[model samples]
Target: MTINPSTLVDLSHKLDSNVQIYPGDPLFSCTPHTTVAKDGYSVHTLTLGSHTGTHIDAPSHFFPDGQTIDQIPLSSLITPLVVVDLTSRELQDRQTITWSDIEGASEHMSPDVALVLRTGWSAFWGTPRYFSHPFLSRDAAAKIFDRGVRVLGVDTLSPDETSYDGVGGEQGFGVHEVILGGGGIIAENLNLGGLMNQNMIALVPLNLEGCDGSPVRAFAWKD
Candidate 1:
């Protein structure tokens, strides 16, 4: 079903230097490669990580044999959606989001739906608190997997704790492994406060071939 044109919510975060990002990731930069006055027309050069700002992570982000960002199916990117708001509660550092939390926000998990978690974390996007935003427990991820969810989104840096490492070890991003590795995708660092009981989401990402991830223009809509 198509959403009514009257009700559309922009679920994406504005990308700029001021926007908070994962530590050690390259900072977003935009420069005038040519001036309008001198060069007769304006030209710009931009540089940033593949996973900057409001972005979607392909399985390749965590798995070596996973699909690239460009390989993501449009049907998976744009589909029915539901947001579970957890902003009212206190979600602390390294805190895990239990399955009970999911059951409290919404009664049913539709198969193949893009499930979004709004932990009210984006409010602290420009500060360190953003890093401490809520995360999904491995059990919660498993629950999501069991329910046949197609994609996941969170208003946090990641659904997994970013304080530790897995670069050369096996203790990797469990949430990502559970979802993306299970034939699902993820949208991170979203600004989903404007959405309200939406039914559909359109996540349009840059068609960057062979890339692990790409920034997205995500929006929520309903009939």
Candidate 2:
């Protein structure tokens, strides 16, 4: 069934000067360039990291010769989605979403679908805990990539562990490399709280030439 436009649920986290971002990355800023009081119109200038809040990471993000953000096709941006809920049942000490969790989520999977992983991390948007939220284990990411999934959207800043290395700090981007290197893109920092049961999603990324990533305004449609 076709979903009504009015029923589209926004799956993007609102971006602002203080939206959670990767540490050491450029801070998001929006300053008034023109005010209605003076110019009869309002305009604001923005400064932000390419991979800022609610953004899509193109293949070029990790692979030097990968596709640029502008090269992402409309077909790739809009697709049927399978929201995989992994956090609702996890224990406090469990942070890595292993392959078993993914297997459980995909028992009735569809082909060529985008998988949106919800970790319940969106609830901590303004806190340090958000940065330390659950991540997809490398083994799990490898399975997803092998399945030919074109896009992986997440409610966390990364699918990779943000604070720890392999033994406690593995700098190698295992998830990013597997997904992007496979010609698959990733959408990060999503507001998936309302999308746990969603079956479709649309990602509209800014068409910036030669860009590696762009903040996207995402939405999910009903079943």
Candidate 3:
């Protein structure tokens, strides 16, 4: 299907040296490899983790033998998008988002569409506050997966709480385990503030063979 460029709303953060980096993850950097003044050409060498910026986590992210980034089918990259707006909930730091907060949006939950949780956390993307954004409860993750929704997206660094000391929260990476273990996908660090109630979005990742994840140029548009 051809998507008109005019209708696209970018859902990805601009990647650069200052791009928000998850704790313990590799920092992003871009250095000039060849300069026009010297090599008669320009080229850049980028250094970043596979999960840097707006990215999709494949099943292999948590499970060793599961499908990898390159193994994901292209047909599954774009789909109907369901945005669950929870900004009004006034969720607090490290707060847990339960099923009750999501039940209202269940009507749109299904296997084909990508379910994105918009917590308005993208506003804090470059600040320390971003790490304290609300997280999904384990039960909530399981329920979402049970509904047959394979693609999960979040505006925060992760669907689960961001661990600072490498020690996990009570729920751990339950959200990742539940979704990816079920052969699902999880898109993180998305800029979803501009998206509408319903639309079509693409979370296409790079074909990085045997990789657990890849940065994606996420975008959405209303049809």
- Candidate topping TM-score: 3
72-177: candidate 3 lDDT, tens digit per residue: 9977779988999998888888889999999999988999889999999999888888888799998999999999999999999999999876544788899999
Error of 3 at 104 (Å): 0.7
> How well does each candidate superpose onto the true structure, as a TM-score?
0.91, 0.92, 0.96
Tell me how far the alpha carbon of residue 219 in candidate 1 is from the true structure, in angstroms, after superposition: 0.7
Off by over 4 Å in 2: 91-94, 107-111, 164-168
Question: For candidate 2, lDDT tens digit of each residue in 91-136?
Answer: 2422777889779766544446888888888888888777777778
Question: What lDDT is reached at residue 26 by model 2?
Answer: 91
Instruction: Assess candidate 3 and give its lDDT.
Output: 0.91
What are the per-model C-alpha RMSD values against the true structure? 2.8, 2.3, 1.4
Q: Rank the candidates by lDDT, best first.
A: 3, 2, 1
Can you list the residue pairs that collide in candidate 2? Answer: 164-168, 164-169, 165-168, 165-169, 165-170, 166-170
Residue pairs with colliding backbones in model 3 are none
lDDT string for model 1 (1-223, tens) is 6678778989888887687767688889888999989999999899899889999999998887899988888988888887787877767766778898887644556665788998888778787667766688878888887877868999888888766343221234788989888767889988876878778888888999899899999998885
Worst 10 residues of 1 by lDDT: 163-172
Ten contiguous residues minimizing lDDT sum, candidate 3: 163-172
Q: Can you list the residue pairs that collide in candidate 1? A: none
